[model samples]
Target: MCAHITDSVLYRHLWGTDETHALLDDGPRVQRWLDILAALAAAQAEVGLMPDDAARAIADHADVALLDLDDVAAETRACGHSTLGLIRCLRRVLPEPAREWVYYGATVQDLTDTWTALVLRDVGALVARELADIEQAARTLAQQHRDTVMPGRTHGQPGLPITFGFKAAVWAAELGRHRARLTEGRRRWEVAQLGGALGTMEFWGDAALPLLDAFARRVGLAAPDVPWLTARDGVAEFVNLLALITATLGKIGQEVYALQRPEIGELAEPVTTGQVGSITMPHKRNPELSEHLVTLARLVRSDASVAVEAMVVEHERDGRAWKTEWAIVPEVCLYSHTALRLAHTLLDGLRADPDRMRANVDAHGGYLVSEPVMRALAARIGKHAAHEVIYEASLAGRERGVDLRTALLADSRVTAHLKADDIDRCLDPEAALGAARSFVDRVAGEA
Candidate 1:
């Protein structure tokens, strides 16, 4: 059964995405643990810790479907331990000779953390692909609307003229930073975990380090120089990185949601058939997808906090903190996955209402071009003095319900610099979008 959003089934559509569910679900996770055990067995054999034939047999038969998950769960609760249940289940499938060597000297952190590395490797790839989609989408929009003039708002008020391309470029830049984050952060995260009891390989002796390297190579992860049994900074850092990624996506989502308001009408999400926004309000086209991006970010951030807070663990192995990770890590990965995927789709189909953008700029009556006008007049008057003059005029204009240009025209101080035509030209919103296309070209070309 799918997860529910709320008490009302009508709004349950935004509960979760299929991709997120798959990434965090029980069956896939169990399968991953089995795969890790198989790799460990093969690597152990190479290091002369186990027989080659036994290792091969263990690798050949470590199938999740072959074991009963219900039994695994039951044993897990009955034993009150992490890998014991899974180990016992796998033992049932192995011959007596192989059963002793199935897991060998590995610990729970070794299995679970390595599995986390595997998931991180895959999750990073998925996030990169989706972020690229969003980046390309924003690029296309930036290029398409290179000259589409709109008001650049500050403090939720129209402040200056800027092109739609410039706005998209800013978003693209932020997403570019996210891409850089994932690229650099992956190396630090996708490291193997194979430390025995108390961060020492005492149980396996001389064969421990070699076996760990072989296992990591077999599993496509880098062998860490030291064990991270109690040192969870890497896990916390990785989760925090995901939190930053989700926050960036949330920023994009919030912008779209705010711009999609009917009164603003600057942008709208792509409307799909059979997708109802509201039942009570017939005339509704809510930014549901973008809003959910924000929601997913919040959930991922909460999970990240748990992971970070868990970093202050007791010596060697703290079940209190490590067990928290068992719950939080997957949760963060799941929602962060959803956020990235949804952000890609939403950005790909985003509709930039250039006409409405222009209309809004025009409706603001030259108020948005105050910065350019002020800058132009700064050459005539001192910068601070000119700012004061323009500030007063702007406030008066708003109070009297007159255009900013009109107020400036009546001001003797501003009139001393130039004529009415110069003011009009300076106030043109499209004329003030400085080097937006150049920036778009630079970033897009690099991408």
Candidate 2:
């Protein structure tokens, strides 16, 4: 009966993690809302805006276990208001004196937005931890394959040699940037929201600012400079960062997908025993984890767009804009977490065929080292002229079905300055890996 794939018993594992689901699900969500209300009451009491005993009573009875969710839903549907149903249901459990003091001077935005900030704070920490783990895994790969040579392709054609370590280092560096971003942006997005009715907090009078700070302290978040009733840039920024992180994961997935091809065979995703790639094809090891990373990234990207769209709102409070976040934020969080999890698994168990990569390069008849040859010839003739010579030689060699060394040896233009030894040096894959190994070391050190 689950309407969305995120909630579906069968498909939920692919779309979200249990940790995120716990944070966003109705049971925990409602409980957090109650906790927030309790914190508000306690803050009001601290500011002398409400009675002390009422705050105590409210805090003591803030448990969500006491409320019937079906009744809450029924009342919500009947009243056509967002938080009133929960407020009324909460009052039923409170004593007479504390009932009125429960949600004093607060609005739906105050409750929901503060809850969102708390969610961001927790989710941000989770993401940072996951990213750190992923970066370490990538750094390990970079160190392990510091000299493992592979064909560095451009536009789907082999261009020159590059170490697999260099590729993994690139991933590690990008992930490190995301970790930095999360650290820098946490304060901006994890501040409390406490705007009442039209964001003025006029109902709370002179005590409003103090109460805001107290409420934030109770909830373990920072007090915002002002209530973000209309400014949704923080939410948008958080989701967009998630988009960027997932996109990087998707890029890694795409690389695995392309390199795992039978013709290429330079890399492969981990396959467990008895895992079936296809129902009909008996000989297939599909890239399910890698492909799913792409899928999760695309969905998270879509959710990020919705978060961005929710930034454009009307006046002090727009239900159209902020309400969209009620759905978009949680979805983005779930999808992003799932991507990070899968990416960690993929990187941890990844298989790299150094021999296959070298063979593929050799199969191209040393053409993958064309860049080094072009550069050596460029020293003799100007760069453009060397490009012309190499271009012509490459074409003729392909037509004649001979190695680049044979084709270049037959051409007077190449043999005039460069002998067989020079060509052999240029064709050396290690020699062609200019700065690749060093870059891996640099990135690994940074990581």
Candidate 3:
């Protein structure tokens, strides 16, 4: 009966986690709204804007289990307002005296935006934890494969030699940067939004600032300099950070997908017992998780664009922009959560083939060591001139189906400056890996 794939009974596991789904579900969302109202009431009472007894009563009955959500929905539709139905339903459950002061002067934005801050705090924490785990796994790979030589590629072709550890070190370094971003961004995106209808808090008079601080304290968030009723930069920034994170994950996935090809056969995603890659093809091991990571990144990036668009709303209050976040925020969180989880699983059990990697490098007929050859020749015959000589020899070698050493030996320009022993040294893949092992050590040591 679900409409979206994210909510599908059979496939929801692919899109989100149970913990995040529970956090954003209707029951928990409403409970959070009620909790925000209770915090507001308590803060209002603390500021002497409302009676202590009424605040206590509202707090006691703030449970979502006590309300008839059907009635709440009908009232919402009847009133054509986002929070009125919920307010009315809440009033019905409250004692007579507390009913009048249940919501007070707060608007829907106050409740929803604060709820968003809380959600971001939770999601950001989850992301940070998952990123740490992923970083550690990548670091482990880097250490394990510090000397596992592979062909470094550029423009989809073998360019030079590199260690698999170097590649994993890159992933770890990027993930570490994301972790730092999360830590720094928490202060900006995890603050409360309690501006009333006009964002001026005029309804509460002199007690506004005090109430804001108290409410934020109750919810364990920082109070902002002002209400963000129309300023959505914080939300946009957080979503965009998620976009950056997923994009990195997608990059890693793409690498795995490419290397898992039978022709390359240097890396692979871990396959579980009895896992079927295809129903039609009996001999196939598709890079399913890697492909899904790319798909999730695309979706998260799309959501980030919507978040950016939401930043340009009209003055004071804009339902068009604000309501978009109602959908976009949860979706970005869910998709990002799923991505982090999958990435962790992927890296934890990732399979690397050292022999296959060495074989692939050898398969290139010493072409992968061209960079080292060019560099060594550069020191002798001026860099540009050596480039032309190597370029011509490389083309001839490929046409003649011979190794780089044979090609170089036949080229008078190359043999004139370098002997066979020098050419052999240049063609060594280990010599071609300039500073790769050192970089791996640096990244893994820091990790």
Segments of candidate 1 deviating more than 4 angstroms: 1-20
Candidate 3 global Cα RMSD: 0.9
Q: Give the better candidate number (1 or 3) by TM-score.
A: 3
lDDT by residue (195-299, candidate 2, tens digit) is: 899888899999989998999999999999988999999999999999999999999999999999998998988888899989999897889999999999999
Off by over 4 Å in 3: none
Model 1 Cα RMSD, 1 decimal: 2.3
- Per-candidate Cα RMSD to the true structure, in Å, reads 2.3, 0.9, 0.9
Which ranking of candidates, highest lDDT first? 3, 2, 1
Against the reference, the lDDT scores of all candidates come to 0.83, 0.93, 0.93
Find the number of clashing residue pairs for candidate 2: 0
Error of 3 at 264 (Å): 1.1
The TM-scores, one per candidate, come to: 0.94, 0.99, 0.98
lDDT per residue for candidate 3 within 60-167, as digits (tens), equals 999999998888889999999899999999998899999999999999999999999999999998999999999999999999999999988889988888999999
Q: List the residue pairs that clash in candidate 3.
A: none
- Candidate 2, RMSD to the unseen true structure: 0.9
